[model samples]
Target: MTTPTLYGYYRSSASWRVRIALAWKGIEYDLKPIDLVKLEQKTEEYRKLVPTQKVPAFVTKDGKILSQSQAIMEYLEEAYPERPMFPKGLYQKAEVREICQIIACDIHPIQNLGVLIRVAGSDLEKRAEWARTSITLGFKGLEGRLEACSEKYCVGNSITMADFFLASIVGNAKRWEVDMSEFPIITRINNTLSTLPEFQSADPFHQPDCPEELRKN
Candidate 1:
């Protein structure tokens, strides 16, 4: 099968989520970089590809365009079942999805690029505080759930959708200088996941378009 194509901005947390998912599944895809900082996503050509004007849009080899990271990850799981990211059993799968949603729905949307931009006009510091607060609250809840479900990864001993979601959001939190030490479980899982080649390879800092000035040495 021909490789799929992914359009994304390097620092976008949503885009980062999809990148980690793709790598974990061992899927090959072409990366098309979009400069969100430059407002490149507003152009007509890009709009045609992503109606929501979001990054991380996927175009299949069959020429279908897909938006949303969760949807793309689900499609990847369904399309390529060899290296599965979801748990095998029914109850385990539900747990995995629940953990994944804690980040995807509860945490990510409120702290996304669009939300941040919208808050820019308001008191910038206050907006950042809001983002940090939301993130911390989410992490606290996830920490409790993870304590019960996690072994090595977020759910069970294997890397699943939960790990991918946590990795992506933790990267975002680090950028904002939110201390993960407050949530030891999350900190441990995040540190462990970061060491894996799949997670490291999918890191925003490792992306081709990543800004050198913003990179952590």
Candidate 2:
């Protein structure tokens, strides 16, 4: 089968989640960088490709198109189950999805680039503060949830989809300067996950589209 294609911005948290999942599953997909900072995703061509005009659009080998990071990651979990991203237990899987949704649906949207641009415009400080507040509020509940569910990872022991969401958002939290001290569980999990080769390969700073000054050597 031909490789899938992913269109994503380098710094997008949702895109990073998909990248981590793809890397963890050992899936070789073509990455077509959509530079959000350049307003590339707003182009008419891109709009036709993705009606929502969002990054992390995926085209499967069989010509199936997918959008939204959670949907795409779930697709990967089902299609390539060898290195499963979800737990076998139904309740554990639900908890995993709950954590992913808490980040994606509740926390991320308010602080995402699109929302930041609309809410704070060009004032970088305002944008940072808005993001920081949103993330801090979200992390409060998230930390409590992790305290209950986490062992070595976000769920029981093994790394799952929840870990991907956690790792991705922690990067964003740091970006907005949300003091991570209050979220010790999150900090520990993120630090642990950062050491994995899959997470390293999927890092925003390591992506081809990252700016030279920002790229990790």
Candidate 3:
């Protein structure tokens, strides 16, 4: 089978989640970095691949175009169920998806690149505040929900889609300086998940377009 193409920027949390899923599932893909800072996403060429011209768009080997990180993740889960993102049991699967939605819908969209750049305008401080407020509100509820099932991972002992979402969100939180020390459960879970090779390999800083000087170990 031919490898799919994943178009995304390194710093994009949405893109990062898809990367984690792909890596964990062991799917080989080609990266087509859509450098947002360079305004490459707005070009006519990129727009043709994705109507929304958004980062993290996936082109399947059969030439199908998939957009939206959460949708793409779910598609991959169903298509490539070998490394299943959800555990057995109906209720448990719903719980995992609930957590993923909390991050993807509630927290991520409000503070995403487009929204932040649009609302922040020229005010750097406001941008940080936007990120902090959005993440805090989302995390507070998420922390409560996670406490019931979280062990080494979000849903249970095994890694699920929730972990991928949480890891990506936490990465963005730290970058935005959200002071996540308050969410001990989130911090703890993220700390554990980050040490894994799948997580580490999908890290934003390790991607090709990540600036050399700005890269972190």
Winning candidate number (lDDT): 2
lDDT of 3 by residue, 74-189 (tens): 99988898999999989999999999999989899989878888999869899999988999999999999999989889998999999999999999889888878789999999
Task: For each candidate in the order shown, give its overall lDDT on alpha carbons.
Answer: 0.87, 0.94, 0.92
The candidates, ranked best first by TM-score, are 2, 3, 1
TM-score for candidate 2 = 0.98
Worst 10 residues of 1 by lDDT: 208-217
The TM-score obtained by model 3 is 0.96
lDDT of 2 at 190: 93
Model 3: how far residue 2 lies from native, Å: 1.9
Residue pairs in clash, model 2: none
Assess candidate 3 and give its lDDT: 0.92
Which parts of model 3 are misplaced by more than 4 Å?
A: none
